[model samples]
Target: MEKFELDILGCGSATPTTLHNPSSQVLNIREKLFMIDCGEGTQLQFRRNKLRFGRLNHIFISHLHGDHCFGLIGLISTLGLLGRTGALVIHTVAGLENTLRPEIDFFCKDNPFEVKVEVFNPKVSEVIYEDRSVSVKTIPLLHRIPCAGFLFQEKQKEAHLLPDMIRFYNIPVRELAKIKQGADFVTEDGKIVPHGRLTIPAGPPRSYAYCSDTAYSEKIIPVIEGVDLLYHEATFADTDKARAKETGHSTARQAAQIAKMANVKKLMLGHFSARYPDNNILLEEASEVFPNTVLANEGLREKL
Candidate 1:
């Protein structure tokens, strides 16, 4: 309930199409924006969505593919032009820092903020970034080149204090944190009030997984199991399964199969190929396999 939302900036594949942009998305947890895959046109889309630039301190890139990272330099330069001073941390596979550092240096020379690039191995899974609210782990994906998907798991929140119960027990304001952490309230007369009586249990933590351009691989099931929302690339329909295999992308049916096998709560199909004028064929193919499937469109927001 504290804002676990995904904003789709672009959903098209390698070929540029009038229907969709490239690959970019923003996951907002508790008002903190975490950008994933800043494809071309991502900066414009971010502004169109009215997201505050200052809140975005981290950007996670799945791979070094052009469509996935072409917008990084532009966004960094824009952040500088906006007079932002906060350090921007980019989490990606190795070689990205070396590949983009020069461009950033030449363009962002007069910028106020520092751009820090963190590298990780795409062959193995690892916890790339974490905060008090959430933890992000990489799901090693199979692609033409090295690629990794991201799995975001929310950390458990503290129990909510009951206002009426707090007032009745006369618990001091300074003791709220302790009570939320499951400490019992003690009355002045030495009577013990159980923690359950003073607070409401926090809701279950939610999770989201993103796999943009990968082949159908069951190895990711254990990592992404039972997530609230699963966004997998469905670049082609079942009829073009051969094409999908050749390009290291998954068909809609294949994506749904992964979702169903993982027992995910919902499946979002994205990274559409330009060949399909209407993506409903892909949606229908995936929905048949997983009934709770949805299409990922530009500017679309899904909460989990």
Candidate 2:
């Protein structure tokens, strides 16, 4: 495992309640900090959780909703005040820069860092972010407004070369790199050495999917199929499922069904409505449908 974990900043829905803040999470993939949403008080939670401020360079906003993005200015301002020299990039749907650019210019004009806002189309599914280790694709979600979820998939890991096997075969060091990449080693004498005999097979790559503020749509099952972890919004229980359907949100059972349908390893439900004093009922409802379900609360962290 190369340090892949998720931290929940706030899990409450639109309203800021005493029990929870709003929708916000941080994914630490190979130590590259990526903020999923910047709800109000996100920076405070980020600091409360002791995540390094300098390591956070990219923020992905699921939509333009206030709960999903209102904390952008405050976080950017705090980063500037802390003298963060790295350029901060924001990826979200179009029309967010128009709302945040002015505030950023007015509040952080003197800072050394630059805040760059990049827009993406929510209607289209595409890889919005990619690096050497991971690729994040957008999952078109059915929400009240234009919104999209994120699917984070780790790149295939390279197999480890067995020193004993290599030495026994007397394989040249020059061919070790290729062997590690799943290529067979061909000896100078024209003997075929299988890759399995030269290196240990690496485990399959891990994946995580984040789905929030959307209705229960089977359209996403293919996009998030067989993920290691799934964070889906469970804004209501079975009792308030009518409310959920009216508000473009999903019930706890609905979230669990999505996980079970997609064959995900585990399901984490978040974005709870503020009316509930605690999420015990929601958890119970979802667990009945999918036993391997967990409730997301503020400050909770889990390895993927």
The RMSD (Cα, Å) of candidate 2 is 1.4
Index of the highest-lDDT prediction: 1
For model 2, the local distance difference test gives 0.92
TM-scores, all models, native as reference = 0.98, 0.96
Residue-level lDDT of model 2, residues 54-127, one tens digit each, is: 88989999998999999989999898889899899999999998879888888788989988888899887899
- In terms of lDDT, the poorest run of 10 residues in model 2 is 197-206
Clashes of each: 0, 0
Residue 47 accuracy (lDDT) in model 2: 91
Residue 206 deviation, candidate 1, in Å? 1.0
lDDT of 1 by residue, 1-304 (tens): 6999999999999887889999999999999999999999999999888888989999999998999999999999999999999899999988898879999888889999899999888888889999999999999999999899999999999999999999988899998999899899888899999999999999999999999789999999999999999999999999999999999999999999999999999999999999999999999999999999999999898988
Worst 10 residues of 1 by lDDT: 117-126
lDDT of 1 at 145: 90
